[model samples]
Every structure is written in C-alpha cells, then in structure tokens.
Target: MSDRPATSRVLVIVPAWNEEESIGDTVTEIRACVPWADLLVVDDGSSDGTRGAAENAGATVCQLPFNLGVGGAMRTGYRYALRHGYDVAVQIDADGQHDPRSLLSLLEPLGESDIVIGARFASKDDPYKVRGPRRWAMVLLATVLSRMAGTRLTDVTSGYRVCNRRAITVFAAHYPAEYLGDTVESLVIANRAGCTVTQVPVTMRPRAGGRASHSPVRAAIYLFRAFVALSLALVRKWPAQFEDPVAP
Candidate 1:
C-alpha cells in the first residue's frame, strides 16, 4: 500500500455517464491507491449499470435527478463534501484515463495551495488523434484565459483536480451548468477569489467504454461559447467578494 497524507481529508468524486465498463475498476483502483479517501460516484443518469457497479465497488453513490453533465454532477459531489466538512475534495473522471495512483501528487499542492489541477500533457499518454487540433486549441485558449486572470494555469481542460474546503464551498454554491468547461471556469473563479492554484503532472489514457461525448464539431462550438461566457464573467466580476482565507 502507498503512504497517504495525514492532514489531507480527501473525497474522490467520480462523474459517470454510461461508464459501466470502467466505473467498478476505476473505483477499486482508487480505493487501493488512497484507502483513506471517501469515494463518491455521481451517476449522471447513465442507461448502463454504472451506478450499481460503483456501489458494488464500495463507493458511495449519488444519483443525479437528470444528466447534468460533468460540471453539474461534480458540483453535486462538491456540495456533499462541503456539507460533510471534508478538508479536500478531488474530482476524477469515470473513464479509466485518469490514474488512481496519482491522487497523492494531486493532493500535495492542496496542503498549502487552495486548488491543484492535474496537467495531463506533463506526461502525455493521450493518442495523437485525441490530442490533435482540438486539445491544441484548448491549450491556447487556457493560456490566454490564465493571462487575463493573472495566473499561469496549465491543463484547463483536465478532469483531475484537488480542492480544499474553501474551494469546495465556493464551487458548490455557484458552479456553471450550461457547458462542460468547468476546468477553466473553476480555475478562473478560484484565481479571482485569491486562491493559490498549482499543477502537478498526471498520466492519462483513452476512455475504456462509450464514445467521447464531445465530437470535433461540438468541441469547436463549445470552445467559442465557453470563451464568450468566460469573457463575460471576467468583465462582470461574477464570482464576487472572494478573499484568500475563506471561512471554514
């Protein structure tokens, strides 16, 4: 067994959508990696047996009323974490791409920093087809957004991340629901709130089952819409009155 952090109160929130093939394996692997973590699987109205599989794998399941996409499901988990008073909450994708063993690296920055995101390209294992023009555009967009937000955030599209109690509270209250661009939006919100954001390298692979939800056409449209929404957020100062030390 790997050594776990003593001060870290970690909860693994997995958002699932027809990931019956991988949910059980993913949960079991996460348990093996961080036995101390409280695993919660948010079933995003999957037609498959993802919910049951996750429960059987010893993970606490939260079935969403509807398919709220990744961001909404993640916020549901975040609300639970806040209500339960967890010190840290980490988001993991339902697909097998995100390595469970890398939980330690993700949480290390959370000890002192407010939020830590996993940088996928730090050790890229994604297929070139998956990493081609789409991800390239995402990285460029993230870089521009980071500069505007006064931070140098990498991997703004990554699903793996760890957040402290303060960040959890902030997100649980006002997470975006329209699109699946939580990474960049969350990073921007945290940065504007004066939260210290950091990144750690992580290894990721392709999904185990089901096709990717975002097609190339959908991705391009999402990118333009996301950019507009984020721009509006920046101009409006939407996530208002966030200070360094949010009350516990």
Candidate 2:
C-alpha cells in the first residue's frame, strides 16, 4: 500500500449473525464492486459457517465471542478500522439488503461530511405503503432530536453508511450500546459531537435469506426504548474528547 493520506483508505464492516446464507456472497459482491476496500465481517456469535464463508470469500473476519447486537458489533468494527488506520469506515448489513455498488455514493460525502447515511427513500424500489410509516416515524423523531440538539439529519435509522477518520475516532470511544434506534445512536452522538452528517439515497433489497430478527413486536419495543434513550441522550452535551486509536 502506498503511503497516501488516511482519507483514501476505506474499510467496509459487515456485522452478521447467523447469516451463513448471505455472508459469502455479500463479501464477494462487495469486493467486486469496491476492490480497493478492506472488507471486515464482524460475526456476531454466529453458530453457522458465516465466518468461514466470509474468510473464504476473501474478507478479513472478526468473530465476536458473543452476540453483541448491531450496535455492539458495529462499534467493534469501528475499533478495528481505527486500529488498522483505515481512513474511512463503511457499514453494510450481511443480509443482502445494502447494495455494494452504492458504497461509492455513500463514501462520496466524506469529502465534505464526517458521516453519510444512505437514505432508502431515494430508491424507486421502496413500496411507499410499507416504508412510509417507518420513514415518517424516523423523520419525525429525528427532526425533534435535531432541533433539540441543534443539528440536522435525514435518515436516523439507516444501516448503510460511511464515516471518515473523525467519525471513527469519536464512535470508537463513546458509542452508546442499547435502546438506540437502528443505528440512530451513532447519528445522534455524531451530531452532538459536531460531526458533519449527510444522507444519500441508496437502493436496498429484502434479505435473500434468513428471517429478520425484528418482528412487529420487537420493533415496537425497540422504538419505545429508543425514543426514551435518545430523549435522555439529546439533553446532554457530549464532550468532544475522543482518542484516535491509530495515532502514533
């Protein structure tokens, strides 16, 4: 690798749980789309062969000893990215939803923004009747939080995203663990820390394999918990002190 600026290095993190059906293909497809990116699959206590499949597909694998949920696995990935000195870190789900080709579009905003969320509303593939309610709820909550926190955001629960070194440093240090809306904890924390955040539309597909962990009941519980947690977090001022793991 050339001794280039940190901004040029990108690492893609996929936090997977029992996704043996899609992990290998996801890694292969991502490598095909962004060959320069270093792919890391954080296997969140998968009993299946997800780790083997990802490794055979040529991605660097980090298998967590226990199931840490999405937020925990993602934070682990951020730590890996920071330790490895990656200039950028991107999160893509292992369930075949996040389009690998759209990674570049997500990463593009890093030139101006510290973090970029791949908004699904921009895609024509979204069925409004189904996604509309979820979108509305997220937008409503995000707007309230943004106004309260003195920040702006488009998609608060988006899983597809890219973050530059500035973001990796911040997240690796103080990322909230639970009750954070599907990845909304990071968005809120980033905003609180004054990190530039932007949203880009990305086409996401239904998982080709395995059932989603979130059912209607689970989603409701998650939403209620997230709202309460964010309300508390929004009121506090996050100090801007974070350690850069890769600093010499």
Q: Highest TM-score: which candidate? A: 1
Q: For candidate 1, lDDT tens digit of each residue in 172-200?
A: 87666656447767776767666777778
**Model 2, position 231: C-alpha lDDT score:** 74
Alpha-carbon lDDT, every model: 0.78, 0.78
| Candidate 2: tens digits of C-alpha lDDT, residues 1-248 | 22223449889999999999999899989888888788899999999999999999999999999888888898899889888888899999998988888777777678888988887655566542234334456766678755744546555677888899899998887666675633766776787677887778777788968886646766566666656766776676777666665578
Clashing residue pairs for model 2 = none
Q: Tell me each candidate's RMSD, in Å, in order.
A: 3.0, 3.4
**Candidate 1: residue 90 lDDT (0-100):** 90
lDDT of 1 at 94: 87
Instruction: Find the number of clashing residue pairs for candidate 2.
Output: 0
